[model samples]
Target: MWFVKVHQNVKFHARETTALRTWVPGLGGAGPRLVAADPALLAVVVTAVEGRPLHGAVLTGAEEEAVFRSLGVLAGRIHAGPPSPSPTAVAPVTRADRYAKVDRHLEAARPHLAPGDEEHVRAVVEQAVVLEPLPLVVTHGDFQIRNILLAAGGSLRVVDFERSAPQPVVRDLVRLPDHFDGREDLRRAFFDGYGRLFTALEQAHLATEAVLDAVSGIGYGTAHGDPELVERGRRILARSRAGTLCPAPTPPAGGNPS
Candidate 1:
């Protein structure tokens, strides 16, 4: 068995165990399989895919469209799966839990934020707690480009569901664009595919709000200490507040479009 140790065990063991069981079976491939409860460590053992990471390499117009369409279809399938029952349930993390985590990080990085930005960040955090909640569904807790693996036969397998939990469908959607720095067209393709599976407005709304929650969380995480993360967070929060975040038209090259 070929061993590819990607990184140290950053996520918890139990969480890693749950993710492998939940996601590995659903992936398509011949050999690189997930090791079952390996005593050595909690990591997936899948036949490695052939494509390079989607970063730095801008997708050509056609490839970009294709990528988005493929992602949309895959995400729809994942979301369509029924939620696990309560005893074996993947519960959605509450806003309070999220806020508290962010609060701690912000306190640690107090000196880094500009005075005005600090106040804005506080307000964003407060508003996040009051947003309406979404119906729980199976969410890929960390669905981003880095986690998606594109294989030789055009097969795209999503990896690292360590954070997979019962979350709103929108939460899953929100992570898709983050890997691409908020690609609006890609987001549309994803939503279009998602729409085919979940046609109801209520379902879409639930997903949308869940995505917003994710955006808020990302903002909180980025703004905690890193300057680049802070800027990225500000952009996400601003676009979200203006109703231009999810399923909305793509913004202009470098500015938020209301």
Candidate 2:
């Protein structure tokens, strides 16, 4: 079976193609096999795999935990190998460069936020920008449940590569905190499956990444008429405001937070 994906944006097409060609090799057949690509037309044909996306599925507690754990393992596999080179550069893999992304999305999202929430978002971004650097990995970019597919035998296949890129490892974790919705058991199961704990730096970096994820979601959702995405973005911001996602910045050493 085969599927053809036609992209509207040239960059998305480049990203999807470069990521599929370079990084998919190490994914061990868990990702679509790129069959053909047409750069001029901004389309690619990939072999289709069978399964429904994991989102919106109703499952028992045990089933949910098992699914999340399996997702964690799959994510680990995507991040396991050495970084691969891209023919077309995505964003530069640096903290400063990533902050620019916040600026871009925040500009679009500001109007949609509740009056004072913008201030809180900015404050969180400022603190996050200064944290020690995190290790980089080839991340799945949009690592949410909607992109995960579950087969009949319970095998999972991760799809969608248009957003894939090398970024701070925590970049991939941006959505899971909200997805877990304060459920420590599911979170624990996921990390256990992933086989490692978050570093101090990655832990600290997540809130800022969450900021980026939220703003982009709100902005894109609003423009595209996706109320669901807008609501999810608001939910993430709410968690940040409540100090669960983004908390007050600790004073730096003996210096103030500037």
**How many clashes (backbone N, Cα, C below 3 Å) per candidate?**
5, 0
lDDT of each: 0.54, 0.79
Evaluate model 2: give its lDDT.
0.79
Maximum-lDDT candidate: 2
Model 1: pairs clashing at backbone N, Cα or C within 3 Å: 32-46, 32-47, 33-45, 90-166, 170-207
Could you give candidate 1's per-residue lDDT for residues 66-183 as a string of tens digits? 7777777777677765565245434466555556665565564455444454555566566555566656776676666667766555556675556777666656655444434555
The positional error of residue 129 in candidate 2, measured at the CA in angstroms, is 1.9
TM-score between candidate 1 and the true structure: 0.69
Positional deviation of residue 235's Cα in model 1 after best superposition, in angstroms: 3.0
